[model samples]
Target chain A: MAISSFHPPQRTLMGPGPSDVSARVLAALARPTLGHLDPAFIGMMDELKRLLQYAFQTENAMTFAVSAPGSAGMECCFVNLLEPGDKVIVCQNGVFGGRMKENIERCGGIPVLVEDPWGRAVDPDKVEAAFGANPDAKFLAFVHAETSTGACSDAQTLCAIAKRYGALTIVDAVTSLGGSPLKVDEWGIDAIYSGSQKCLSAPPGLSPVSFSDAAAEVIRQRKTKVQSWFLDLSLVMGYWAGEGKRAYHHTAPVNSLYALHESLVMLQEEGLEASWQRHCDLHQQLKQGLAELGIEFIVPEGDRLPQLNAVTIPAGVDDAAVRAALLADYNLEIGAGLGALAGKVWRIGLMGHAANQRNVDYCVAALREVLSR
Target chain B: MAISSFHPPQRTLMGPGPSDVSARVLAALARPTLGHLDPAFIGMMDELKRLLQYAFQTENAMTFAVSAPGSAGMECCFVNLLEPGDKVIVCQNGVFGGRMKENIERCGGIPVLVEDPWGRAVDPDKVEAAFGANPDAKFLAFVHAETSTGACSDAQTLCAIAKRYGALTIVDAVTSLGGSPLKVDEWGIDAIYSGSQKCLSAPPGLSPVSFSDAAAEVIRQRKTKVQSWFLDLSLVMGYWAGEGKRAYHHTAPVNSLYALHESLVMLQEEGLEASWQRHCDLHQQLKQGLAELGIEFIVPEGDRLPQLNAVTIPAGVDDAAVRAALLADYNLEIGAGLGALAGKVWRIGLMGHAANQRNVDYCVAALREVLSR
Candidate 1:
């Protein structure tokens, strides 16, 4: 049977990511399409790089958005930096770090793992020890903020540890880039990737990424070609370089990029530190409300990500049932726990445009109403 | 400097792909964002698979849109099907065909070349002879419609030849899906990938791909892990499978899928055969108009893709200047020939929503005025 046009419901998105998009971003997304190489389009692309650099807190010339989602962005970092038989130390605190291991193994790199519990942040001491054990390791990789659990690692300390070990740093900033404090330059992160949907609150297609000059050099000096042609940064750079003339790569997700551009523009307007503070402020309001409802967070106070609240599911509260009620009755969508945290916690997100008092109070009121019954 | 919201001009997109998107599809794209795992979103996704099956003219359960662009879709097919050291006959007639060879080699598959000149269809006789020489060749890969050169190959005959040799067919339908007559089941194609921006008239980002049951079986039994975690079909199918409960793969590009679903609905409403015929009809109008202006086609009439017309630049007519004037003065966009045909041909596309009498007239008139000036 032929399907007609899909009209999705206007749900209040407080999920792990894909936080509520703003009106401005949606309007920008609906703009008329442009050829990827149109002069005007190219001009917009140049502006996009400047905007992305500002959001990422990096002045790296190689910074740009990956055409796919964050997983591809992670692959771009891995494939470009690590060639066959290369040794790297990886910190696995949540789901994404495991994905990084898959990328490493697939690209013929050996991963020396520094393990952490599901809801806890990566221990920098353990990461340093892993590098110490594998002295020949050329890279140290970790997630800046684990979306599976709302745990923010100390990226500055991790990068410093890697630097001490004479290794470059690869950071997964998918859930933290626009919602929290992410200073790519100050943190000395060599390579990083973030999702457009998370914190950026654009559509869920593009992955913004950046590489330091030292990281770009690693890619240039690689002995083997990048395994995935689509994720190959060497070829991708020809198109995204934003110099005099842009080479044609794949069709840039034109409309999606427009949405991302708008999101970054909003980020710039709010000021990076201000946006981070907004998420923190809203997170505190939600926390107090949840506390009144007798909820306890899974991650420790100091290590937790303000943008993503991971609270323990109350005893015998029926996790799926409450979530279903929230969706069906309140039109509010929260996250189910993933991986090891499954059925144990509810992830409430206050990200980007969704990071405001109105959303936070609405979420708490909705949760209270749903949970009481 | 901070960039504000991007407002792309409404250009008459007559490019090779990213053909003009209609107002309905753009409106669908701007609809309220839903969580990727929202129940309503899943229902829409199920509907999407059904509509995609209608568009591809197949009943394969594996039919769905890849969250990335066409190049990633191309990689998805290659990575899933071609195991290490597999011998495949790659027919190179255009830029995409050469990309397939890169995919093959990158995946450790040996590519036996069946060379065809750019702007020409793949030769079936040479393909058969090549297969005769390499009886162990497991796959026959070729482009059904070459976007770079505006040539159309006989997919039915090519698939038949591959079937006769006990080889599977991997067809590049990136430019052929809705704008041409492509019957996946009738032709016994093992795998096919297409771009939403091409004949579907959806904004770019998603690549709709389908796999025969036999092809799916090959992926299920692969000896080695897929090189790129993002392009891995085994994991991707977990989310796109439209079953009772979905597994989390990567976040689906929610908004882009909405646009694709709308485009498929429009195709279904118009009727597939009618849409194909409409493109052909518009091509006739464009062809006659271009001929009046003494514009000669790069591909022979018999082998040309009606949706994309590759015409030679008039003698001493500066290619870049004419295109620039067309864009600046008339707000029209056309494709310049890529790879071997660059600077020699202007690819005039009558694709999807852009394939209409009004657009054809505007394009020809714009060219005539630009050239006269």
Candidate 2:
């Protein structure tokens, strides 16, 4: 019954999510507990909103972190916005896009899917054609950066097309938000959701989401109540938004929000453009290193996300074995391909706090050694 | 855009969770992130499962923390265990119990109610009567510790009665697990869910849940798919349980598990019996002090939970003013009444590391001073 201290092995997290959390964010996670409704914590909550707005590039006013991870964020958007029998168009290029389809179907909405090949960006023309065919579609859902495939879709164009088709847009910015360019307002996105762990480099468990006035109006006019009461943004908004009289929903995750606040602060300090550039620069460095080692990327140069690098497994190399060896030998962690790409690709992420010159160099060198062995 | 260092006010957290996290757990929270699938982290996950099993007092192999809060944990249990048209008898005493009903109804199940007054423990006889009337009821669900009322129910007796009727039991032990005696296996409970932030004193992200083999069998025999693919325990168990291999689930929260592991270690060091005794002793001291100040209890003595003390609001005392004074002037927090008891009672929580002689003294002295003003 002796209390053993937790001793975690330090690893360079270059995976899709839970990207290496900064020490400052970790310290924030260690902040002394505050009551969810304490004025001081409320003040922190307000600052967190402003920071989230800055990170998401939206002034939607209904922006806050869902108490769960990114998948719940997706559920929140769908459950709150789309009622039963609503027709929605889901553009699927990777795992997250398919999740959106699942969410739409789960909400009892009809999903009009526009399929794209894995490891490729969602084609705006294909989406436009889908919308043209299904003119009654109420919303357009797509992944901005598909973590499963390391492809960055053209969200700006897709949202524009959806807007033209009189459809609200729901973008999955889970893996893209902090590491790439995402203009939620300028792109006319109606609703967007992102995770804290991926590009935000906080521990997973808070999902940041923003709803445009249009999306909020749709929620306001819902004929049926949101089926899942917990993810209902209407009740959640009363707690997350407002001046003084915030209604109690459930207990807010205080320390996780503190970590998120610090992570956003770090993101703001680095400046979004600079952070995006850093990811690009480090990804280029990694790409050059991998190219030198005779590795080919699954995603082509033009469509690949700087945050996630998907490489085709070489003929003689074992994808799982290489990842395992990297984890064991160098304490460097990366992601394996998911779903269709499973065992076919290795995902090397240079994301958020870990997207730096040294880590790119280190990961490439480590992969080379593991591949050779 | 400057990276400001995070400086958290050192407040005494006496409100409902996130209760005062100990310094040791806070240090554990700041540990480096590890890959969820990393061998070392998987080792931690294994240890975490064992510790949670010890805490829940269940030998169920299907035990682990859901990568979300208590609410999602509630969703997981209901979504996984109940299929479409399943009849569940929900004993509603407070908000969380209402949430269980919501979870059941959302999963396309029928909710049979056994209503209790908000501030009272659920009547086992009422539950039995409901079961007798609705013979198709598949399970009995209730909150072990009604946080809204600070009332404790007889989970053991309820579970025993359910077992006699050939029904399973789902217990919401969110606020009860560590602070009170939760004999999951001994009580014949089928499934139980708890929060990390309550008595475990970790940050509020992970939810510890355990399912008996009987409940697991029900999940295995489900005729329809669980609506929530993310929370489907069948898939989650493949990742959280078993040996040698783990299928992909969502990325687990790494550092949060580290903190949870440390908190459970702390829990074991104190021993469950000692921890329960400490809570009871602190509650008695607080009761004596509050009685000295002419305060009366909301629930009868035997039915009240030791960790959550609900006191009737004194006449001529501004509930908001006293709570604000405690928070703003003394950096102390106390919970406000919820639901029907709102403005009629004050819920003061002395949970996890917060349940100690010194905290009880400080909280009493602070309340006395604030109330005197």
Candidate 3:
């Protein structure tokens, strides 16, 4: 069977990640493939580790990308740190948060879920109360930026509460790392994971993860062996640590890591706070245009994520039809609501390289044209 | 914090895996990122699905890449198909087959192991006898190419045995696909998984997997839910089915899929028989050169893999020092044996684009130079 050469249309990506990869990242993806253990590649791996430390705002030595997507990052963090019968407090705000609860249960951890409305952010008070109720919980897990609902929770406050109760914190910053303020050290976050596609403008394979010293100590002291050998950080550390000698783990996604390093390099070039500000600026413009088009935002103004915008479907409009029309007619892509809020909202992402004035305007004009018909 | 650009050395990769990526595949990886659901991207996804079908030599519609390494691909197959209390017969000849046993227990399935020595092929007689004893087993799993020991097992005979017992087969062709004959349909193999890096000449982020209609029927008829949310094929199939109406699973690793597609295209261009012949020819030359140097192979003739040649280290030689000397002096990389064979054997790979006269000459010359010191 013969396959044609791929040439994708230059569409404006307003969907959740993969947002838009920069030209630099794309070129890096095409860069020459190297053996994963090559000294040059290992040197680059060291730079990637440092860049990840900067991205996650952590000083943790055990920082690197998992050779998988954000969901695998979730699995890596959960399966490695939590053993059977371990108690975890999961705060469910959106689809990703619900996934955290699922991971906890699947990893043989007892999940004490603190529920919130689908479109709203997780309440810090509710989390504190849950910790009070489940004082024996070993860790607190929550999403910093809920991609499905475009709501940003208070990760710092959540981590503070967990630390007060002598528990570790696992933060899912899949959509927040470069779009908002995530201070892993300042907030005392024990373990944090992010997606390269969301706000790093890289292809969606590598998941950047960081762990504080305390969390590393806990993993080192685990009573049982990590269930999933593929994701065990203790074994993977030998490959990614870049300190002394490197050992053979699984073959790393070498080109994908190159793309991630390029994306992170671009972020560093743009300046992290400036990049966050740009996402906010684009979000404001997108918010204004959507309001002009008679669409309402699902998330509250104060809690809304700057990078991901969740807009409610207008009455009598076919949600799927509008998205389909946008894709077919305008070549603009957006995300449908997930889980409990499915068919009720559309998630338009203004993330990383995609968070620009041009894309915001194009997405806004395209939506208006599609919905008007 | 400052970060430097990634510049990988142009080294000839002749290691066990992560073989040299073709320029066409690298170019495909640099393509612009698109939403996983964009129409143009979906069209490309259709092409990828068709290409994967050709590579696996099957018409299984559920075939697609797991967005992780080969190990996670193994997990996806076992976890999605086997539920708790399910009985599976795993044939362990090398590290990967032992990994299958781990996956079985992690997914809560009972494992019946058929053991063979590390440097030997899986004894089909042992597997058939195991089926005789455990006729109620739902599935049989084994590695087609044992990467650790460079042994080639009789997958066709094993699959035939499993079929006679009305059991499905899971074959780990991670190191064998595209290097040798792999007729998924003709052999009646139920489920097969392979890594892109081995012989596809792509990076290692994606795993190509295909399932028979019979295996799909079992997944459809499972009594309990698949535990891993990310690897649940039901959700993944909705996105990767190559249909116009693609559901949102996790974001696909866009550029990596492009690389996999391009590699498959390159394979088709070379023709499977020609590619297999190239590997055989190169392996013969490499064997002659090693024989001239008084080196001995681990696996017996006819059982040895053409792509992965496992050679026993000289008794007086320092394995680590010699490998380090080769890396430092010549920038050539070769595999040190894994698991039980570690420090005892050197695995020389003639895989995909790395299977050539130049690579064979370079590695042999480098070994001779390094060993003389």
Q: By TM-score, how accurate is candidate 1?
A: 0.99
User: After superposing candidate 3, which stretches have Cα over 4 Å from the reference?
Assistant: A314-330, A368-373
Local accuracy by lDDT, each model? 0.93, 0.88, 0.88
> Order the candidates by TM-score, highest first — what do you get?
1, 2, 3
True contacts kept of each: 0.92, 0.62, 0.70
Which candidate leads in DockQ? 1
Residue A224, candidate 3: alpha-carbon lDDT: 80
DockQ winner between candidates 2 and 3: 3
Best by TM-score: 1
lDDT of 1: 0.93
* Backbone steric clashes in candidate 1, count: 0
Candidate 2 colliding pairs: none
Residue B144, model 3, lDDT: 96
lDDT per residue as tens, model 3, B172-242 = 99998999888999999998889999988898888899999999999999887676777888878988883
Model 1's chain B yields a TM-score of: 0.99
User: Candidate 1 docking category?
Assistant: high
Q: Clashing residue pairs, candidate 3?
A: none
lDDT of 1 by residue, B144-235 (tens): 99999999999999999999999999999999999999999999999999999999999999999999999999888998899888889889
TM-score of candidate 3 versus the correct structure, residues matched by position: 0.95
